[model samples]
Target: MRKSFFLVFLFMTLFVRTEAIRIVGSAPDYAGQRLEFFTVADPVSKTPVPFFEVTIDGRGNFTIEKQITQNTYCFADVGVYRGRMVLVPGKDVRITLPPLREKSFEESKNPYFNPVDIWLKVNEGNKKELTNLIARYDARFYQLTDTYFNQLYYRQMKNYLDTVRIRLEREFEKEEEPGYQTHRHLRMKSLEADLLRTGREKVAGSLQQLTPQEWTQPAFSDFLNRLFVNTLSTESKSAAGTRMKMWVARENLAELSKWTQDFTATEGSLSDLILLKMLHDAFYSGEFSSSAILRMVQSPWFSQNKEPRIREMAASVQKKLAFLQTGTPAPEICLPSSTGTIWCSGRNTKPFLYLLFADLEIPVCREQVRYLKTMAEKTGSKVEFLIVLSPSQKVNNTEFMSSNQIPGIMVTDTPNRKTGKEYKVRSYPSAFLLDGQHRVVLAPARTPLDGFEFQYTDLKK
Candidate 1:
């Protein structure tokens, strides 16, 4: 009986260790605020997938737990700053946030604004842990780089770089954790790349030699992304680039992959990844046919790739490019009005659906909505005007619409901001026009203040 009890205890301990990563933290200055933790789902896009949110209590204490199988990078938006940390499976982390510094109105409204990234204070962590090791190594690396920037860059001091590299290697030599090993190796390589002034082709050659799979590591992906930034623009001008464009034009995945391998001197899965990067980057560049690239992503070559990561990433790419473009089907929006009636885009009665996402708190959005009333009055039955509101905006919608004579259906998105995210609505007054079949006609269909009346008149012709 005693032996069985001990075995049971050990098993339970192991199960707990392998199952969850718990974070216990405090932000005394931000009491009652909710902090959402995010992890990268698709490394190439670096899209932040929200894992969980914890609300700080009156005392500014919060605890959250998430299931994970490996060391995962996690971050939380604390006011205008993003606090980041590496979470190890089975280990509990205790941290303290810095003082709250909220975002200004303009910053909050800016869609392209990024939060300042800062390392959270790990109040409870062993020095041998990957998080601690990485933090220490980065600090030293930054110090060394700062101390010898000019000497390394213009002076071409190989001896100085060697000294820095040796110091970093010696200090971190004992870290056997696979994640730490990859991070250290990539950081050292990046340092070498900088000091040696390695050209893009040489970096590409070095990337080809790297162990083919390190997609999960932030360091590896960072290096990969930096090396391939704007590759489409640069490569398309090359002699090989013309053939690559032809392959993409034909929606030929096989030839595309081959082109990538030939151009970069990389083989197999690495070349496939590089090609995906190129396709993803070029999607918004207007350098290639977006529709053709979208078809290639949805092709069987990617969907049935032998590598699971490639399949997953390709699916991610497809989802991102699927909507919001001209001729693509608009994302369905079915929301409830204050009067309890459900309004859906599919049930539109007009030949065209004019969808408007507006926040009343924003002056510009309010101005546009007023302009919309005039436009709606003139359109007659040819167009259906729909307005989406944020959940936080609490007003007598019926009174406001009636007062403004805004002839439109008003609906508020749920607290999750689902509609806004689906429409990729970042600013206060984003608008889209959909056709009779709910296909996107004008991606950002011009706002009423921006001569959308003339644009719509022309479209009606």
Candidate 2:
């Protein structure tokens, strides 16, 4: 009996002594501050461990202790800035964060702020180096922004592009980077290529001054090719594959189409195929018709497979195309509210439902609320408006709703970003309009109705 008791006591003592690795960090005061901590069980797992919180002391020091049985990952998020750290069992960890200044819209008032700031900080106080870095980074950033802008806001982006070109030319003349002569030749060649594509003769004088060597560099040639291909593809949506499409069109469309069909039939990766299909839909579909897009999405090919990534894309495509088709019911939205709880269903509502996700601190959302108030007056309760608060937001949803005289139901999705993901709302001031059946009618209502001076007739018609 004593031998058995001794063995049990030994096991209990080992269990009692078990302790986890501790992580400690300090955050410096810079603007409004809070440190967010998150951990993942493994590198492959995308989902973070729930119910973990980093404890912060009054002095800005924080600690996170976990009995890590396996490899664990952690990260600190302060505002928009993020830093990652990892800890293993039996390891001591400490992290120090650099003070980060809060970003402000006022900084954008200076036209050269981005270029000059990058030049000064990253280029080691070298004027020439700064200029070169700015040119490259700006070009890349604008290219990315422009690609998305064309699909969303083409005219506005075109006007911005013109302004950017003018700024680029003005800056190019003053730039004194080493190899100025060679760089200038390359720069002028690129500018000429771009201008020629624009079909503008105004820059003909500048184009005439380029050297032969400037046009031969592989980098310059590659850039020209990509720019031309992108421009052509944008001009003609029917062009599906990048290089393959060009080659196929030059050879034979029937053969190319058959090959693509066969490849898709094999069905290696549904996600990749769906992505290609989305691109195809964007390019080949002449105009946005709900029925046509819906039919393409609901075909057997899309429904046959089930993968998380594919499902997400399929849902997104469906939301974008057939959100408000007749006979379809609207998605149910039930969330917690300060008073108790609020629910929004298409059932029992007049034929229209307006859902708004607003951040009280955002000026754009504030303006949108005023427009909504006006809309409510004009609609005269014909429309139902629901405002949902983001969980991470600190503003009192009730106070904001009451003060704004917002007419719809107010709800909050606490702790979980379920509502946001359901609607695919990544940014603030997102709004959706659903038909009476609770089906999505108008999604991605990004443009404020007020900004456009939208009248009641717009929605009614």
Candidate 3:
């Protein structure tokens, strides 16, 4: 009877030990496509761990079960798509990944893979799991690419490349033909290109021997070029010059330019608009004519939908230009100050008000105080210099006032703290100017106060 009880106890323990978490899902119409699964190391340590994977049967159903340690994390990757999840051992978890739509899976045609978008998306959900996954993938890719291809080091690039190639081949062997075939090929090609550029002759020869068909695949082409461009740009002699030349040579320049014009004209999404603005700033600054600006203003993207906010921005830009040229009255700033609430009346005798918010501990703040004192002495009639302290814990108002010899009415709106936010004072010693009518007369100034003066002489009609 005791022997029988021991056997039963052992059986129950085994059953509990074998219990697993199951992740099951079906692809959106998984008729032709096959699902692939794999796990990467925890990002930081590069330690290997078992992960669940399932390929859809003919019926479009896939179920992968993993026996996991409690609170352990793992990454799930499917073709170009990847996600991260944490598993509590003995509990089943279900995750339904949406179909791989063209919109969702589309890689940026930009030479850079632009990891920012992927990183942001991964980090948006389940931070701990995502962090571990990112660290793993980052380490893996770096090991695969940097260790093998980086030429600055004389270590055996071939050894690392060979290992990666063998691992990739084994992965290909396990995957179903023609479905995941393209993805594996692309990944290998990217790795090969990285190997070739390592300033190693043997690796370069092997890459050159690849067939025309292999070279022509879109995935392969995109991955190879991206790796090449990023690596070269990062490590090349005269990197800036090389990148500039490459940018000028790219066929997408016309498309990018047109897109910028359309987006600017139509007042598109803020994010899209910002990207176009940055591209324009990079390529067209100091080179684009006023005629070009006018052309951009007339593009369909700008013309089709006139957003009020965008219109306001354009008007504001025009106003800023006017101020730059002829010192037009700018925006009104009526925030509280340190001593008592001070309103810039704009009716002051001076043409401009040099409003500065400073922190006492900053050396730059001390220099600015000296500069303001000099300006007060020199441009006493032309500029009204006002210095405000950004109230801090370390600063004593009484001591600050006495030591700085601040001539203006020192003020603080402590409880509200509205002034700092209103002015967007991100750093100490930030300054802005106002016209005679308390209108903002100058652009937000971040640079040092020295050699900075405003004279609006040429106002555009």
Best by TM-score: 1
How do the residues 1-461 of candidate 1 rate in per-residue lDDT, one tens digit apiece? 99999999998888655567677887789888877788876666666688778988999999978887667787887778888888777778888787889888678767899888776767565677667777787888889888888887788787888888888778777778877777877876666666555453345555655553456677877777767766877778887678778877888888777767766667766777777888888887889998998888888877888878888888888888776778888888999975789888899877899988987767788788888878876666788989997765445656666798877788988765779987888776888999999999998988778878788888879
In terms of lDDT, which candidate is stronger, 1 or 3?
1
- Taking the tens digit of each residue's C-alpha lDDT, what string does model 2 give over 323-373? 434446556888766678456454446877777876555666667765777
lDDT of 1: 0.78
Cα lDDT tens digits for candidate 3, 1-461 = 99999999998777645556776655556544544443433111122244544667776766777775334444444434455444445555555554453323224211223222122132233323323333344455556565555442345355676677675555334444342354354555455544444442122233433333233233433443343223222322453445433443452334444443342232233322332233333322433333344344334543442544334333333332234222445444454555355654343566666677666656667677656655556445666666666555656754766676755545553432446545645566677766666666555643335545423222111
TM-score, each model? 0.86, 0.44, 0.40
Looking at model 3, which ten-residue stretch has the lowest summed lDDT?
108-117
The number of clashing residue pairs in model 1 is 0
Give candidate 2 misplaced runs (Cα > 4 Å).
1-77, 82-232, 235-332, 335-348, 362-364, 371-373, 389-406, 411-430, 444-461
lDDT of 3 at 382: 64
What does the lDDT read for residue 18 in candidate 1?
59
